[model samples]
Target: MKYILFIIITLTAIFSFSQDKEKEALLAAKKANNYVYEGNNLINEDDFVSAEKEYRKAISEQGTTVAGIYNLGNSYIKKGSYEEALYRLDQAAKIATSKVEKHKAYHNIGNVLMENKKCKEAVEAYKNALRNDPSDEETRYNLGLAKICAEQQKDKEDDKKDDKDKDKKDDKKDQEKKEGDDKKDQDQKDKGDQDKKEGDDKKDDKGKPKDEKNDKGKGDEKEKQQPPQPRPGQMSPQQVKSLLEAMNNQEQKVQEKVNAEKQKGYKIKTEKDW
Candidate 1:
């Protein structure tokens, strides 16, 4: 049983060693130098699309080297594919063999981040680039610019928020003002209707139609003709004058009698038997 266990362990070790050897051979077989040279030539001629293909081929052949990934990332940047460029450049930074290569990776990463409007992240990337290669004045300048851009971006966002809040408040006030104006208009209309109704009731009590007031006024001159008097023998003016004189004398006698009774402290009340 012990011999079997030993054999199993030895076989496992042999298998692991063989796998490592195979992996090393595969890595060694990848020759990306020629493809990278060809890609560079294409890029110099401004043939970025073809250069991207060449760089991709080189990356596939070289199994992720700094040169292949950085070139591919540069090509992607020319194509305006900032997201892909950022990914490739980040990979280049992780696997870079030297400080110069790492600096280039970080510098390109900052460029991609800036294009994507990630100013704060870009500032950090440029700072990293400067750290990797302190002699790179361009990276230092970009870091300064990124800092400025981050501040400007924050200011712009704050301005937008302020403007948005102001607009919201203005809209609310306008709505409230509109509601108040509508209510005022409605109240005025109701009062006008009530006044019109009252005027109509007054007209009805006076027994006049709305259109008859001017019509009745137009007939006033025609109504001014005197009524016809009776003919002679029906009544005489002298007889009417005599009857009036007799009635006056009777009224004077009755009034004198009433005044004499009132002087004797009497409450003289006149009663009507209708």
Candidate 2:
């Protein structure tokens, strides 16, 4: 029974070793390492496209190692691929087993967010990184920068709102001014029309002559403005007395002439009344 037990134990150990070998073969650690090395060298040379390709290859082979994914995220950042960088950095943070790795991942995530002009999210990311590694001066500095950026963005939005409101007020004033000008023109036109109507009512038409009675009424108005004239059968008392005195003077002159003729003759003739 002891011999049989020893043989069974030896077979179990051989089966375990085979399974380990197969798993190692499937993982291809050496291949993954080569890709990662090539990717790092490409990054150093600033060949971002090539570097990204190598990093992706490494990730496919190694199945998301912290170093591989983090480097890939950095490559994306250098390429200005913010969304991709954010995704990779977030994945790196989730898979990280140590505080150092977590700090680096969150720091890179903050950088990506900052690049995208998402200052608020960047601030939170930097804060998380600081929580993981409090001694990181870079993260603290970045947090301060993010806060300043956030304030500047808010001020910009407020300025835009003020400008919009000012534009609205200007438009309203222009509308009111236009309405006022239109009303003024309309009033002038109405006044002109009213004057025209009055003129029409005062004048004669081609087919209808002016009324004689109206002419007489106008003459009466003129008479009221002047002195009264004498009528054919009527005269002032001063004028009548002047005319009677003139007639009496003329009769006296005639009588004197007649007596002078009679005196020169020295004879008189009388005729019988018939």
lDDT of 1 by residue, 1-274 (tens): 9999999999999999999988975764455766788899999999998888878787777776678889988988988988899989999999988899999999999988998889999999998998889999999998988999999999999999999999999999999999999999999999999998887875755667566666677676456565446587666677789999999999999899999999999987788678
- Per-residue lDDT tens digits for candidate 2, residues 107-143, read 9898889888999889999999998999999999999
Q: What C-alpha lDDT does candidate 1 achieve relative to the native structure?
A: 0.87
The per-prediction tally of clashing pairs is 0, 0
TM-score (C-alpha, index-matched) for candidate 1: 0.61
The lDDT for every candidate, in the order shown, is 0.87, 0.89
In order, what is each prediction's RMSD in angstroms?
11.8, 14.1
Error of 1 at 28 (Å): 4.6
Query: After superposing candidate 2, which stretches have Cα over 4 Å from the reference?
Result: 1-30, 94-98, 207-274
Best by lDDT: 2
